[model samples]
Target: MHLDPAIDGFARYLATERGFSVNTVRAYCADLCGLATFAEERAVGTVDGLTLELLRDWLWEGTQAGLARATIARRSASARGFTAWLTRDGVLPSDPAVRLRSPKPGRTLPRVINRTQMQDLLDKLEVAASTGDPGAVRNLAIIELLYASALRVSELVGLDVGDVDLSRLTVRVTGKGDNERVVPFGVPAQTAIVRYLQAARPALAAADPGATRSGTKPSGSALFLGSHRQRLGVRAVYRLVAALLESMPGTGPAGPHALRHTAATHLLDGGADLRAVQEMLGHASLGTTQIYTHVSAERLQQSYRLAHPRA
Candidate 1:
């Protein structure tokens, strides 16, 4: 089959069969689009025309262009998945990417804001929220709940009013694979959420009626709403989190996930159980949540060096 239609079919398979998220599907689509362009240049227009050698050369070109090892690695994975799928579907006689490999990206420790920094950041937001601006109030609630619950940005935005049980100080979020988990937050988050629901949410929901570009009805059930009264976009959350973390000392990503990392690390530092942290984080594997242990160790070493008089 032609590469274009084959790529489309692969995307649907990812969404339906693999249950991949929209962002994952989009990333795969983009990476495969690059492969498609490269294949076109080589006059390899069909799925069967793609060779392992071409795949390697495309990754090599990415490396030559100084793309990060992580990016190249992701591209390699995308190509491997595409070829394997095509082979399984009988479009290709064999998987061309069977032996394809890319350089493994180095594991960088996640950035975690210490408790003091987190407090100061939240304090600043609280002061801003004192102005009673709906967005500012919502922002405080967002960061509070994010730190308190360690929620993924998608999960945070996907929340509905009914999902949160303010009386119980817990929220039900549909995480990856549409799995639901009820995560608990602290008293601060509970208070902020109550305030937002009572004072800010209604005001935000009653925002401009003409802002219907997202095709979502204004004043929808989304827990977080933008000025348009529609569910807040992921980009808005990213922009807010990125701006907040920009001034922090960090070598890694400064996205909403950083707050998650910070939250997990803080929990571990406070002697929270490893398995408990994993469950709270909605991690399927205990191994995935162990990274926060490393962060805690590093922080402990830093504190020891700073406080201990011995060389």
Candidate 2:
């Protein structure tokens, strides 16, 4: 089989048998495709022809090309997974990547927005909405929901009209791995959503008014709509959040995920149970959630250093 065909088959196997997420499958494909390209340039034709020396050469080439350590490490992991799979399936006699190694990547903590900055952003959003612009209302709702529910940008944009229950102040979000969770928001988010539904959605729908809607018909069933009245995409949500942060003072180089980190940290700061915060953040491991405790502890230390006189 051609390399591309074999790679396609392996991707299908990952999706169906291993149940990897789409993002993971794409990363695996990109990594293996790079290797295939390198092999093709050297006239290598089959998986069995792969060797540890060839893998090392590939890593050296990547380093020569100035790829970051994180990228090189991920590529090594991808190669190892593919070679192990091929060996297990009898496509390769041995796993050449078992001996391949890459440099370790530095651990970077997630960026989090402070509570005052978050509140300032929300206050600015509210002021923008009072200008009678419907888009302002929609933006306000998006920001509020993001910070309130600690949603991934994908989860936020994937929301449909029925996913929100304003009366109960809960939103049903489809998280990573397609797992669905109902997360509650505070009154601010609920209020923002209500205003958007009442004032903004109709204006947004009216601008397009495509075959997708009418006086009724639930306004096309998307909770967030683009200017063209289609489902809002992840990129749009990202740009909106980035623009909001750019206009704020004392904000760091944070994105929508920063809002999520801020929400999770604040929940822990407010005495929410660690496991409950984990569930709300859709983290598969409590260890991931426990990082917020470290953030909280650092904040407490800063407070003590500023308040105490005796050192």
All candidates' lDDT scores?
0.91, 0.86
Over 163-217, each residue of candidate 1 has an lDDT whose tens digit, in order, gives 9998899999888766789999999999999989999999998876776566667
Q: Show the lowest summed lDDT stretch of 10 residues, model 1.
A: 211-220
Instruction: Write the residue-wise lDDT of candidate 2 on 219-292 in tens digits.
Output: 38899987777777888988898887775654455578888988998898999999999999999999878889
* Model 2, global lDDT: 0.86
Clash number by candidate, in order: 0, 0
Candidate 1 stretches with Cα past 4 Å from truth are 210-216
Residue 71 error, candidate 1, Å:
1.2
Which one wins on TM-score? 1
TM-score of 2: 0.88
Model 1 Cα shift for residue 219 (angstroms): 4.2
TM-score of each: 0.94, 0.88
